[model samples]
Target chain A: MTAAIVALGVVVGLLGVLVVGLLRSHADVLRALHDLGICEDDLAAAGTAEGRRTAGRRTTRTTGEIRMVPGVAAPGASSSLGRLVDVSGVDPHGGAVHIGLEGSRGLTLLAFLSSGCGSCLDFWRAFATDEVEQVPGRDTRVVVVTRGPEEESPSEVAALASDRVTTVMSSAAWDDYDVPVSPYFLLVDGSRGVVGEGAGGSWAQVVDLLRKAAADAGLALDDDRPRFTRRDLLVGRDRELRADRELAAAGIEPGSPELYAPLHAAPGDGADGEDGAR
Target chain B: MTDVSSYGITARLPRGWDARIAKRPDPAGDPAGPSTRAAPEEGISTRSAPAEGDPPGPLAGTEHPVAHLANFPLPPVRGDYGSGAVELMRADDIFVALVEFEPEAASTPLFSHRGIPRFGVNDFSPHTMQRTIAGMCGAQAFFNRNGRAFCLYVVLGSHALRAPLVAQVNALLAGLEIDPL
Candidate 1:
């Protein structure tokens, strides 16, 4: 009777786990597959098409980790990325809001632009026409960082914006972002973080990264505070101790807990150094 | 610098042309792997990979840079260069073609850069050499360098062999009248 009971419980548990896993992240899984370019209709063709390496070139026969290209190495970008720069070069109206906020965060910048770039003309015209929002910490009634070449006359700036656009004439601190091209705004998140190879012509992609930059600035607002969480290993110990209680209850003979107390660990976290197996 | 002495043609072939030539055993013995999937009825090793006793692929063109060397022998029928066997992909009227060049297999391009030319001997006809080379056993024409060099390419699957192979084949033009580039 006891064996029959245990068998029934195991079956029920497995079925429940399967159903829950399927319900969660099914949409993300589908998106990941689509991004990976896997499709049911062209599965066979796709396999052969992308399956081979560059045409005529011999397939590289080396084992793992030996790289072909040199110098351009990825130092280490493990966690979330850093600050992004959004260069806005449009303004409408006179001096009141025109000349302001160029050198705020010790950041150097250079923006090569004129009203000539079609995409820039469109975005600037929109901001000048609409009320823009101010980025936090900076003393500004309206938003948007609009600075450009010294050659650009006030009339050209006016031509790009409307009464609503809040303009700022900042210094072209060139060394700050390592300005590669025109209308390029490079943002260094801090001394340690830098953003490169960003969207140059595509405004939509730039705007998305711009929003990410704002979010990144907000993260920096924690400023001087020493913030610690489970990743710091301090509070995490309490959580680990609590996890022990649950495992203890789940083990054989709870209070006494089978001669050896069950130790909890991740693949590499074990003190016994079995981590090398991974 | 492989021991080419095993191939009967080695002594007759020049020492300078060695790097461009790799002798491999005929894959006719292995009934599996890629060569097995080739034109098995023809008895030639069809897989693009070279087998023992095979020659290199087609030469790029008539004006192949090394065409001047009179003594350079094309890859011999049966020799081993440590990179498997030589593969011969083409033999045509445009050029007498034999492909051999091992890029990564052997330590250097041509071990010691030493070579020999066996075909340049008095009796062999360089002008009508296409028919003589096409008769090589295993595989027929394979391209060593596509059209890049004065090289010829016999199609494999849908693509052609690349440059490194062509350079080797060009080096094989020993005893030809053309001036060295």
Candidate 2:
């Protein structure tokens, strides 16, 4: 009987705290509305379920646009794989490895990555799952070149160690080739010559580079365009929807809806002054 | 023979003059002279010749290539020199250099005298090339072309060659062609 009485007292105390908290939250909202000079009637309307739902819809309607800058079109990128084979590093199983034109045979895709880089983590998933060998017309191999001791690599990088994907722990190759930035790529031919080199700012750009290299080698690519994953699309959509709702709630109008859309160059459209920042 | 086609500027050579593009070597490897951004260790010292049997550093026994009219190794080679700036012309006591920098993302006072937003080196200072500028005048100018910033630096040691070379430099600037952004 005493135990039952204690349980009842605990439940009653929890209910009282919750009720007081709700009342305080309502009072705070009303105070904010008063500070904003909202009339009592308008405040009452905002408190209604219909008014709140309409406000939410309006918030979603005010969304910002994000446009991707077009990547550099591949030049007449022919193969000139380097004949000098500079040894990059030992593999995970303690085997020697060569990258780019330095390798003995096949096309070597050199990926300059760092464990601390956020972008590398983002695109690494796509890169790992992409059916690189099925690209037709070339025997492609991927090698990741990074810095520091192999054992000290982050979990994301350490997970990429395998027979298919060789990881190196040195920047010597990068310095030798004068790679300007991280996540850069160098495509090499069977004869150890450079086919093409470019910045891998996005997974799409990297895929496009490889496809272009394959195409330049006179091989047809089988719909080689990089496609976003289902998760990527869903997450992106959710973020946009949230942004629209939040923007509406904050009373910020979406600036230039067309900027959020894909850019289609119209006839005689002068320079957009967008390149100035890039 | 001063038609330097690189960096989109064409410079015509005056009679009895010739020119070729060359990358500037690093002082650590080739201490031939100091550059505009030369470091403290790259002192304003006289060009030194190495004693016999001395191992080669970059400038150990080699005379200044421009002064002696010899070939200087091109850059993009590790531990040699910067890959950007190149010696466009070296004839008599005059040296013309050209450098190209990637475009700036936003126009933030990249150059002086022009309010126009552009990209490039705004803080360039002239460095004395001891071998070439023993007794001469040097000047550098900046401009934007083809969505890249270009630096045209001229060093003239002989007073006799300055006027003619200035005219050639002007001609090079006049014939410049930059693709629209």
- lDDT against the true structure, each candidate: 0.30, 0.43
Error of 2 at A83 (Å): 7.2
- TM-score versus the correct structure, for each prediction: 0.25, 0.28
Q: Can you write out model 2's per-residue Cα lDDT over A127-203, one digit (the tens) per residue?
A: 55644443233345566777535433533344543323446665566566666556667766633366666665676
Top candidate when judged by TM-score against the true structure = 2
lDDT of 1 by residue, B1-181 (tens): 1122211112112221221211221344322211110011122332233432234322221111111111111211111211111233322101122333332322332222223222211112212222233332222222222212122222111012222222222333322221111
**Chain B vs. true chain B: TM-score per candidate:** 0.20, 0.42
For every prediction, compared with the true complex, DockQ reads: 0.00, 0.02
Per-residue alpha-carbon lDDT of candidate 2 for residues B74-175, written as tens digits (9 for 90 to 100): 111111112111232223234444443345611323322221121112211234322332335454444554454544444543344454434444433443
Model 2 Cα shift for residue A210 (angstroms) = 1.6
Candidate 2 yields a Cα-based lDDT of 0.43
